[model samples]
Target: MKKTWKRLNLIAAACGILVMSAGQAQAMGLLQAYEAALINDPTYRAAVSENTAGKEFRNIGRSGLLPTLQYVYGSGKNRAEITQPATNFLGQPTGGFAVSNYDYTSITNSLSLRQVLFSLDATARYKQGIAQTNYSDAIFSARSKDLVIRLTTAYADVKFAEDQLDLYHAQRDALDEQRRINARMFEKGEGTKTDMLETQAKLDVAEAQVIEAQDNLLNARNAFSAIVGSEVTQLDGLRAEFTVMPAKQTSFEEWMTVATENNPEIAAAKYSLEAAELEISKAKAGHTPRLDLNAGYNRGLSDSITTRTQDQTIKSIGVQLVIPIYAGGYVNAISAQAVANRDKARADLDSTRNRIAIELRRQFNALQTSLTKISALQKSVNSSTLLVEATKQSVKGGVRINLDVLSSEQQLVAAKRDLAQAKYNYLISFLKLRVAAGTISIDDIQTVAAYFSPMS
Candidate 1:
């Protein structure tokens, strides 16, 4: 008995060391995962880069309305020889032809400025740029929300996989113990071979389940690593009593109103529609007159064959007007194309609204259903726990077999696993509902993070 006690102590000490080692491994919380994704996620980074580049569109459009100034300079050496039939002032032909040769360097410089005084097309294009910028901002906002949801889901997946593996391990150990008890009883001629064989078979199946669960856990961890851009050995687990709240807005119509106003996809579609409308106006303006203010200065120095070296400077400022007449019906064709595009844009906006509404409804129902399942599963877990204990007591009373106890244990673990999955599903559905409503934010992530205790 003393040696047995000593062996048990050693086993306990080894378990303690394992627990300590596991504790030493750093735990990644939801917020930390989100931060890592923000820095490392290629999709999010691409969205950021697109947003930054999109802001330049406004400047490009505004340039058309602003004054443009340019300066040009030219210098060249010129040599010229002229020969002509000799003709005197007295109008008499000479025996030899008159020849003249000249060589000189010439320089010319000019500065010009042009400012659009009135242009409908330019104004419409500028407005379109503003709308496009707004569209990019909405797209970026949507991507940010998507990142949050993705990271949260991935984190939950890892926790679920871990829980499953742990449950499998526990079940396998319990079955192994039950199998050993049956084997000993059969050797004593008390238990039947059938009972012992049943337990052994169950133990083998449990061992197989553990292997599968381990593989699942590995895959989940690898998926999480892909998102965080690093290998993850451990993560903070959800609290045992994490609460899932119902959505703030209940009715579909109420949620739809919020989504229509706040959803990034809807906003982007609206901006796209506005931009398309402006494009139509710009195309129509192609037939309208344009006015501009122009000013220029020119200076030149050159030696002429008929005159001595001369230098000249000219400065001029005036208003220029341009009236479009006809361009082989090109203007009309473009205007028609713009009108067609505006129709397409309008259709796109409608499509976006319909898509968002469908998603919002789906997520709303999923969240509600998950919440209900979580409640039901919690009660089921409690009942299964009591049943397992009762089965164990029944075995002691010789009314139930060891296989019965093992079956109860399996049911209890299964219930617990389902409950954990339900909870995770509830949380994920809640976040997805927020995403559909275009209201997901870092605050939501922080709230979820509150449910996780750091690895200790």
Candidate 2:
């Protein structure tokens, strides 16, 4: 039974390995992933479908203002019974009655036309449709730009996760080598038993951290795959040497003005307000009069019982006017409701403006701060590298212990990790700032992509 269990475990492990290998056949670059997402992303596809449907609103609204024509043809059988008083031959009193029966087929055809001459309701609805269509366009534009930001964020997250895992593994390897060194020195009477125990403890902790980092990396990869609709085994990495750029706009006020003018969300909200105003107009129009031109033609064969064998044709044209007197107070109530809704829309527009301003400030400030953070971390990494080497030399000369060397190595690894984190943060902040300003585009993405080199 034990041997059978062992065989099952081995088979399961082999299957997992095979699945992983098949899941990631090639490395995906940022641009390639973005292209794949554009085609495969469900969210973006939904936006496209919504935009397509929204454009039909105009047609629907205009239908009320157009002329309508209809034709009707009907055929049926008709039967009638007639009764009359009977008279005697000499015109004397006659009480008897006579009856006659007749049967025939009747056919009729009609053509009618109605053209609306005036309708406030129809006009308001047409305007509303235009506003709604504009709103849809703005929303689609916002969503399209959001896709770029979302994709870049996911890409950055995966890269950071990979960086974390690599750093942890490096730390683990350093600890493991120190453990071996301590063991050898203790055996040769050059190191103390305490040194060996300490190195072993650090190695154990480093191994646990490595395990956690691996789990994080797996999760990040899964999230990225969900967006790109495919598993990615590798990705491009940031160049070893690159320059950090500064924000172009000098003042926060300038950014705020730009966002107000260019932000798709704000535009959508304004359109919503316009549509709401039109709704108020439409509701009030319910109390107004309507006028239309009406024309019709009719033809009949065997028209009625009295003209059973006669055929007739009639054509008429006239104008119609309709004035609303009362509708159980529905019109007034609906108009008031529309007014309230319009107020709500106004409030929503204001709220959106405030929220956007807050986000714009946060991303702008973060982008500025990241430049300084990256510069500081770069220097820290450089100094940490030198410190690690110096500590190792001191240990070889009997001036420092194994523990000192281990600490210095750990510090160096930490500095490198921090530097990598800062770089990723800077890139994300820069992109987010652009998103907040409503200026994010493919060119911005391409520029960012240029900062990375494909992993060999």
Candidate 3:
């Protein structure tokens, strides 16, 4: 009964693995991974949060354009101040006392509003905030683009590894059958020892490759799950596709132009510069005077039981001027810092443009090379298969050695693997191009989905 139970457990485990594989088939794909990242990726969430904070900054500057209001209401006993008195006419020091004291409590309340008459710095600062918000939005979009590329790369790696595993397994299975057939021939005394030994050697090699392929699959899945913010117990098999052709005639200068105009980092740097300029303007305005307008009206009575009589309401309007004076050089230092930051931002913009151009060219070259490689690798795989078959027949006919047949088969397997890697590289390079161009957003998902949809 115990032995039977052990066999039953083995069957159950196999069934579980098959079920899990089926579930994985319906799990999220590369596009879904990217979508999950938008909400689940910690880095992306932080960028979005920072962008939200930037939006609030614009409201702060709105105060300069809108009216400022305050409500004031108060009632207190008016007590005259008394200080030390000098000698009176009698040559004796007079006692310090309140000279005249009367009930002087009045209820005063008002809502005073002040609007800016002229403020250049305030307007500039607001524009700067607007620019900052726009810049953060661009950053968030760029981050999303980067995340998509990452997901694509990771997803592709797992699929590539899986394809390799399949190839290895197939090769191993073929060797297993060869070994069985050779063993049967040896039992019948029709096969030489050399043939059976070579078959056994190949079986060993095939088993080793299977183990290696499995390890690669495990590593690839681990990486994929890490990036997608979820555990990947199994991976769905995918076809080798999703490659795009590079432009036949792409000029470096044109690429640079596009990057400078459309790269989010460049736009963000420009916005940072604009924000710094606004800061300088604000600091410069620190030396200027400000005019404040105010008004108020009050109607409230004191709650003293002894004096139940109510106080009359009072209202007042006035204008006030604020003149700037020496301020410990703080404002000057801020203006200098702003100027320095603006210079740095300009340099960053230039540097970012250079980097973007370089990346575009790199991805373009990689994609082109991979395309050619995939084509060549396909031919090699076909040619290698023919060679392997011919060599196998020749070896069986005693025209070739067993080692030669094994070597040819190994070469064929290697060709298939190389082709798989080249295909994976091609897809990765294509994704890099989209990311470099700053176009890998939800729009990329839509485009990919459209391409994958039924041709009918």
Candidate 4:
């Protein structure tokens, strides 16, 4: 029982450390998420790991330029036998005598070192490793930008759902009030039952809208949670913002220039081109001669009993050179393949830049369109507000029918909805333009959120 408590404490400590880790962060904004993801994201981390492993090629190449040292030792015992005629210094051939030794011991030890003078393959691979590292760094930056776009879309959806839900509630309340007024009029024999029924039916439709809005909100919340690695249970609306977006200072061409220069996709493609060039150089390096130096030491000890025994030690040092002889043209074929691949990489980069420019044009136009719609819609709302008031007064003067007032109110609701949609479109278009301008940073997202602060 005491051991169980100790184990539980240990487990809790581990969990605490895990939560404190950079990658385990809770809900974060787009920029915060970008920072956290750059630190914690598995794919980027894996690329970093691969980059680190690739760097070992530097050491491997440098090894050929450095010395290799070695030491060795051995000991052994053996038996030997010898037969000879036994004679003194006087050279007396007395009789055949034999001397047999049971055992003898031997020991040996040695050390040696060697270094290479020239190796083109090693030089090329070392340079390639440096290039690969740079490539991986560029890829990491691109991934973070991608995360920003994904999270922005998800966050916007949540806000849209929230706004739709609010509209439903507002419309529903307005209809409920109408139904109550109509009910009172009918009781007084001043209004028809049909009027009450119509208001009630509209209220029911608004309630259904609320239900659908709730479902959309839930789905948006889930998407955000998946991206930010945290559950989103609460959402704050941007309420204070009720204005048209200002026009852009720069033209579409200038925006495209900025996007092409700073966008991550273009940067990634540039790096890929560099990597392919390096690979081509690497493959061609295979045709070059490689030089290496190796050294070894060995020692042995032996004991022999019989005729004779001896112990010995051995040492050796050497330099080796390998020139490509022939391998069914594999080297040439690979080098040619690398060249073709480099051409493909370059072409891919061109295609990517073109696609990016097209998107920038589309999004820029969309932003401009949204801004124009917002200005027009603002004017429409003001006119519609006056029209609604005029219609109500006419009804009081017995010059307008009740149905006419209801129709104007319906038009007002529709205009307000159109305004809501305009706001949504403007929000989305502004973000798109920022994305095109390579200004899709967390600060830009926060700026959007700030526009809604008045409502908050």
TM-score of each: 0.85, 0.83, 0.72, 0.68
Q: Tell me, by TM-score, which candidate is best.
A: 1
Tell me how many residue pairs clash in candidate 2: 0
Question: Arrange candidates by lDDT, highest first: which order?
Answer: 2, 1, 3, 4
Question: Residue by residue across 352-404, what tens digits does model 2's lDDT show?
Answer: 99999999999888878888888899999899989988998998999987767
Candidate 2 vs. true structure, TM-score: 0.83
State candidate 1's TM-score: 0.85
Each prediction's RMSD over C-alphas, in Å, is: 10.5, 10.3, 11.1, 9.2
Per-residue lDDT over 203-278 for candidate 3, one digit per residue giving the tens place of the 0 to 100 score:
8998999999999988987777666566665544334453555452376566556666667777777887788778
Pairs of residues clashing in candidate 2: none
Scored by CA lDDT, what does every candidate get? 0.82, 0.83, 0.69, 0.66
Off by over 4 Å in 3: 1-26, 72-110, 163-216, 233-249, 303-310, 391-409, 439-456
- Candidates sorted on TM-score, descending: 1, 2, 3, 4
* Residue 153 C-alpha lDDT in model 3: 73
TM-score for candidate 3, please give it: 0.72
lDDT of 1 by residue, 331-424 (tens): 8999999999999999999999999888888988887788789889989989999998999899999999876877787788888888888877
Which pairs in model 3 have colliding backbones? Answer: 109-297, 109-298
